[model samples]
Target: MTETTMPAAPGAVPHRTLPAGALPHDWRAVDEGWGRRGPDFATLSEPSACREYVALHHALGVDHGDHLLDVACGAGLAVELAALRGATCAGVDASARLVDVARVRSPEADLRVGDMHDLPWPDATFTVVSSFRGVWGTTPGALDEIRRVLVPGGRLGLTVWGHVKASPGAWALAPFRLAAEPQVRNQAAMTSLGRPGVGEAVLEAAGFVDVRRVRIPFAWEFADPATYARALASTGPAFVAIQEVGEPAFLAAAERGATAHVRAGLPLRAEVDVTGFLARTAAAR
Candidate 1:
């Protein structure tokens, strides 16, 4: 499909210029998913999310003095960590409800509801700009905004979603089909962690240099069905999906069965493939 160019609307929000022709369709699915349990989603993501952000800092050899920005920060966890490292941390997200919850849950960071394509800040405002699970379906100009926001010599860090087939954490969802509209289900199948390159040519086209990405595999472990269900509820998308199939009883039972192969105290492992990338936003020589 041919992509279109979309600029910022108005005010402080950034404009997204995506190549996808059908973005207007089913945008609400993601919004509702995050809104239903933004807090739970944020908390559930806290564990691995922390390790991922810390690795970004170390991988880039970034110092505490640098200013950092997290694009599409769901609950401010990454923003919070950036602040801990002594950088001026800020987060921007499109979900108002999520941003509100983030403000209440994480008081240390400054967050706003905005688009990723056209950021509100001035050009070259940050030393490090990272995104977690937000760059999917990036428009043509979105990468340009990322480059425009970072100072020369700054680094852009991002994490892309891995394919569900490769990600064990998402294994259960493989068999569990959703009854949502056909479009939503189709989107589920079409999007993969590797979909956006979260670390590849986008940066190259956006004028960034030295782009690199690494594949990191991790697991989500649940001792049994009960614990797994609780953890599963934290994901807005998964919660709705499970609800659509049936109630908690059915979901719990499904979890129990999926986890049957594992012994007690040894959590059922769900594999996730995470690609972490770092690129330098440098002035063209």
Candidate 2:
């Protein structure tokens, strides 16, 4: 948590501090994939997350006095929204390209490109923290880092895709199956936190208190199947599928999956379950 100024990437805002040592190999790989279509994600995919961001901020009571940090804050949409709600905001993501977009969106925010497992802020630097579908079952260690930067009794809000297979939007995500088998397995592990009682157990184990679940509103809407395919292709999961099957194959499969859901004049809509968790750091004794 000690502050050390580090050189910022080209087009990135000056970071508050840099994590010690080289970036983790796994995180670098993740950054490579997600940063592939950064602008497409910023313009097409990230807007759909507005409802989730507003809902979680409401649940956490974010306001003018709060200092907020958004972990894995893709393109800084959530951070921008928080700033509009009058909270001072900061964010971090592994993808430098995505972070560049975020810097443009929220010029004053303390946004950085860094690993979630090793946040660069000093201890107890934030009053609230949020991660929308960012932290996963496979990265529960990130929770320990989240806890480190929150002041006593500080709030935490997180979201994860919930009951995805049973949701109306399942079709929208079906193309992710084209990823190699190991990537598919990793996806399952990532979403495991959304299962019943799973997130609460993990939060408590990480020393968070008052853990509870809340339903978050989420949906994906596209003007047509082709647009849907374009948006999906911008996501990290889709990048994995693209790696295995190639971008053309992945886009074709996504378009085919969405075709049945298309309406003549209406946008193709997919409503998926999203689970939100609200918890707090233990109070100062």
Candidate 3:
């Protein structure tokens, strides 16, 4: 497939150009933190993102004709789901362990352990691309790479945490506060794309057009507070907390945070606000 390029729209947000051989963030640390409990994340944490995956795929109109690539695909749940819908699916992630699980789950998928900022695929390879809360404000460079791998007018869909503190399930994220102040601050920066106008501006800057935002469903359900703690500990953010205060302390904090949300017989549910962005590569000129 031939790659296409379009002039930036007038008055669009200016894109930041990085110096040669520079990376936007520490992908190695990200890989280690996320891959620490790869199996646990696949079984426990990845399921919680099913709603976001389904919603975004639907929004992007993923179907049989599409060749899809899922960035930061974690354990490949999204890739597996897209394949079920008849799309030819591929995925890439920073974590080798998670990529292993993903490969097992979607044996037919072309899954790779690599950096999102520099995808291994050729230009104009995919018809649709997605990243569920994987691409963040700090990683705008990944959007450029995503565009590079997408065919002209190819669709892109991504999700990010939205107004988390205002969500009904805000307690679900309380355990992350156990991390050191520096990590907490970095977490805040990562989620900044979820803020109003932030993601759209960044997408536009990356030369994507028709950018729009939609609210997507995101919830975490656990059998009990202990289960909640275990699930929380499997994620990357929780790893930071676990490092600052040992895993035992972080687990205790998570359980305590979830205690209030427990019900008599129902699963403990934390339904947090998640924002989804849908955009398209500039059409052939």
Candidate 4:
């Protein structure tokens, strides 16, 4: 499919044209949001999401000599693990606080704070690019950036939420959906790749081939409703909620939603159906 450029809407946020290492103003919220959750994300989000990273690395046949870049790499745990396994790992994120933690985790790895739309690297610098629960289908420009940074024929791995209807913890999105902007809510819904063939189509539009999607069991388990709620409220989605309704109101609503999921005297558990997509760029021209 041919991709067409669209003009920006009135008052739309301008694209980031800052130098590779400079921070974009629009990414401030992203930085602050993820930064606020820096510590917890390592313990809470990474545990569940790291499975996808491992799965992607194995699928792409990543090796010790390969240069791998993890975009929106929060807290750097995935990069640290990859480096341990011998891959020359690097990562970039909008959150400085999260990047700090990642530095401690992977001190030798090149970790930077930069916008995903304008990654900090020369073109075609990486053999593999991985983004776990980071890039959304709606952000084709970000995909283009990923494509630009990858060596020709380099592989890309992305994970997005699967069909929410099929997810047991779909209700966890209520606060975000209720409180976020329409665009943010739509992005959070993750409807694009959930549809048959849509994920492959998006990749193809971004100059990728051999696009494939694989289902993975992604889940989150919390020992208590209150703790779960607090953790949930720390993510990007909850950032939108907190901005809309303030942290106190957002936390109350999150707690209510989380408490509803408590079952069988067990901790609050959410079976998040996640899909990982893999694709390769065209060979270097």
Candidate 5:
């Protein structure tokens, strides 16, 4: 087994370097109601991650007893599945609120609130490392963290959000047409995915190899306009931002727009790009 540790931060820590930890920033504001929506994203996110897990298990010959680390493990989505699969699973995230929810949602996990740049564990601590729909790191810190923890021949499994050009993950917004102006105003307040392959290039820079990419095309379905509107409002970052612009009027309008779309019987399909990567360890001499 090869041992590794997250690389040192460029300048210096206010304190000494910590081991594998979660992100330093707070994320609870954006992720608080993550698992409470109509469809359990907790369940949706991981099974979707299963394809990559299977790839790693097949390519690297993973053992059920191998330790697995789920990065940015919101609401224990990947945590529960890892536990169910018989791996000794742990999760790390920047949001303590989400971590707490993850712990309650999947009591079987070893969840921690720490930064990917400063993981809490020692070297060669995990056999498999995985992350789901997480925000991009400002630096290549996560890759450094991953390399540090994985053993020789250790595998990496990541499910990344693919770039959408035309739709741009924007179909759900159509149902909320009434709320468009407000939503657009709301979206102005946050960070963004700058462009495509930004993450892919970062993964390469972090020293990962055998990077395989694929897209998972799926539809976000709703029983009706009201349900669809609520579902969107309940979980999405964009939807949340719109509420800041006086939600009462926008919500009412969105509801009517959504009802119109529902009656039109449009499929309302949007494609999501979920890419996976697999790699091994070297330079352990």
Candidate 6:
């Protein structure tokens, strides 16, 4: 499958790099949210996402020496997994605290704190790029930046929460959305690529080829409704909801949403449907 390539612009586009200590002004909110949830993400989210990366590695034909980049790589767990499979790894994330955890987890890795839209890398920097629930609602500029940093024919993989209709916990987002202020922008980002063909269209527009999607079985389990609510409240959108409606109200709504998924007095288990996309850039640049 042929794909259009973004011609290298050399001096025309000055490669932008951030100071190792520099971070975007708006990143504070994200940093705070993820920082608070860093341990949970490391214990819960990252493991769930990384469990599905084996297929992605196979599809991309990752090799021992391949340079891999995990965009929006929270806690660097995925990069650590890739390193286990023999790939050299680097990662970028918006949360300084999460990056700190990642640094400790993969001390040899080149982990950086930065926005996905303005990655701190030069052109053709990686052989494979992966983003787990990171690319949604990101601007076209971010997509361009992803393509720019990939070598010709480099593989790209992204995972988004699959369409809620396909999940048993279909009402998962109801409480959050219902409580979220109407003025909250990009509130739909959590499920932006959830619909059929939505993620593929976005990837193709960014010059990706051979785009394919697969649904992976994932579930979030919490010992009780309160724990479930707290976990849910840690998400980025939940942060927005907390800001709009306050944390107490937000967690109340989350608990209301969580009760529906509780089972057998064991735990509240919410089935998550994850849709992953794998595609490649054009080989002949």
lDDT of 2 by residue, 1-40 (tens): 1000111132322234435323554566556667778898
Clashes of 5: 18
Worst 10 residues of 2 by lDDT: 1-10
Candidate 1 structure quality by residue, lDDT tens digits, 17-135? 43321122233344555656666566553454555667776776656788887887767777777776778777876566677766775676667666666676788888888876566
- Candidate 4 lDDT (Cα, whole model)? 0.73
Whole-model lDDT per candidate: 0.61, 0.84, 0.82, 0.73, 0.54, 0.70
Better of 5 and 6 by lDDT: 6
Error of 3 at 74 (Å): 0.5
Highest TM-score: give the candidate number.
2
lDDT of 6 by residue, 88-149 (tens): 99998777888898999999999987767777889899989987767664344567778888
Q: How many pairs of residues collide in each model? A: 13, 0, 0, 1, 18, 0
Q: Return the candidate ranking by TM-score, descending.
A: 2, 3, 4, 6, 1, 5
TM-score of each: 0.76, 0.92, 0.91, 0.87, 0.68, 0.84
Candidate 6: what lDDT? Answer: 0.70
Indicate which candidate wins on lDDT: 2
Cα lDDT of model 5 by residue, 221-267, tens digit? 55565555554554444234344445455455556665644535564
Model 6 CA RMSD to the hidden true structure, in angstroms: 5.8
Better of 2 and 3 by lDDT: 2
Model 2 TM-score relative to the real fold? 0.92
Name the runs in model 4 displaced over 4 angstroms: 1-22, 180-184, 188-191
